[model samples]
Target: MSQTVYQQHAYRSNQVPPQKPRPEKTLAQRLLSAGQRMLPWSRPTQTVSTRTAQVSPSQWQKMKTIAPNQECFWNEQTLEGLTGNIWARVYLIFSGLGKFVILYFTPIFIVTLLLTSLVTTGRFGLSDWIEALWAYFLYAIFPASIIWGQFEMYNRSYWKPKLLRKLLDAQKKFELNRRTGMVTLYKRGGKVRYSYPFVEFDCILATTPSQQGLVNYSLLLAHRYSGSMHGVPLGVLVTPHETVAEYYRLWNMIQCYMDVTQPLPDILLLEEARPKDPTTAAYDQQTGRNPRYWRDMSDDAYAEAITQIEAKQSKMSETGPEIDIFAKAS
Candidate 1:
């Protein structure tokens, strides 16, 4: 057979085969990619884990007034429990003033400078205006800054005792377990400075009779700015309080409130209070230690133990002691 035209054309052509059409990007995918490109600095937001306050055994003993079994809670100190050194307090005072100026006054000063430049129109040069502004800030605003620090100190002193009194009065109502004593939270950035002081209370809420396990709840009495202000000498100051009864009220009146959502401490005491299974009870009676103490046992051993206990329970249920059923029936 002679070489056909088809074979000649195929041998002469060197063009590459077309690739499968690139898959079309979905709208969501395209938008997400665009957003990622636009926000180069953005990263996934992370939860900052806070370290709980650590109390020494002696400190704990000194802080706690009630016995281990009693439900009454008390923290002997007032809210000014975490008073730092004088130098530290001075640092905080200056820091707060600097923050206020940077955040609030800087913008106003900038706008004022711009307006003055526009209105004065060559009556003063930029240097002259800048000098005058510096003078005005130093002479006029500096005193105000000091006053601001003093006002904050005064507000803290005033509200702290009132808050403590409220807590003391509320404590008379229910049996509360002392969760923490005079905890001083440190601000982020690894600095050993006073952030705030708080005490936590844990209470076993009376659950409905139908419920099995005790309802563990906690209330955090912390000092934060209440956003309300009191008129002081120079200016109004922010009030700080626990805000417990304000947000949570009964019959339109302030009432003691407990937080329901915060993670409770591992309630070993409550677990001990719970009625144990017969097998576990027997084991506890023999060993005089909680059955939970054996949680480190091998998985196989644990499984075997549970199985044996269940089997014993089933056997007992099947052949348990009975009354005279036939006589009762007759």
Candidate 2:
């Protein structure tokens, strides 16, 4: 966070993080960022994104504020895509089942055919027995056909590429590159359909109602002005909150991620990657923040930390520290 963002947090909370030098961007990056800002609908109210100004006990990581964390595979350079486990599980289940049927049932049927073919040469072999074997073969065709299809179509179409997609955690087909400041959407076969600056996306909060009279919140990173696309599924909030601030906090964390000027959002998952980011390492050095603050802590200490964060959540503003994410978009 910048000094202003920290000041806002310090006023309401006890912790005051020291400000560090902002990371320098290359001339090309500067020009690209500037071009993205010139886009019309990119900024309204200067796009103040409320951010949680903490290093440890990240709102999304420590608290169950979101599910299947969007930044599960993030780094100093890029954040690998994350989506629900449904598709990955789908790939695993179908692939495993197809392999089992082909290897196990296939050999059993082949051996049975060989044994039965030998029987045809014997007294049990003649006319009626041959007809019976043919009938059995007919009965086996459906599964045999499937096995043939698996051999014919395997890894060429349908499921193999989808498996690759889930392996990249890209069920949604988008890649966020922090170094390039670009969000690239992929076509079915990993083709780059389009690339836009991260600022071109508008972080939207969606409200969903369930049959049990409960409401759920999720985030979307939709294009600021385009309607051709439905945008990316940021992630869903699983933990219930007394207010909507937690959703905003989730958005803030994402903004913190893509904004190279700032450090990686301090979370347990990203702890190891912090030292890899020059800006983050510098910030940690200046603030004297423990490198393994969350990692080395005892499980009981973590539980107590969680209790403290929850207590603070009750007192947090309806929105967190309001800082203009699109401040450069003038």
Q: Which candidate number maximizes lDDT?
A: 2
lDDT of 1 at 17: 24
TM-score of each: 0.21, 0.51
Return the TM-score for candidate 1, rounded to 2 decimals. 0.21
Which residue pairs does candidate 2 place in steric collision?
Answer: none
lDDT of 2 by residue, 78-126 (tens): 6655445465566556656656655686677667766876866665545
Worst 10 residues of 1 by lDDT: 251-260
Tell me the deviation in Å of residue 87 in model 1.
22
Cα lDDT of model 1 by residue, 147-189, tens digit: 5654444334433345433332222211122122222333322
Off by over 4 Å in 2: 1-72, 84-172, 187-189, 237-243, 318-330
Instruction: Evaluate residue 101 in candidate 2 and report its C-alpha lDDT on the 0 to 100 scale.
Output: 57
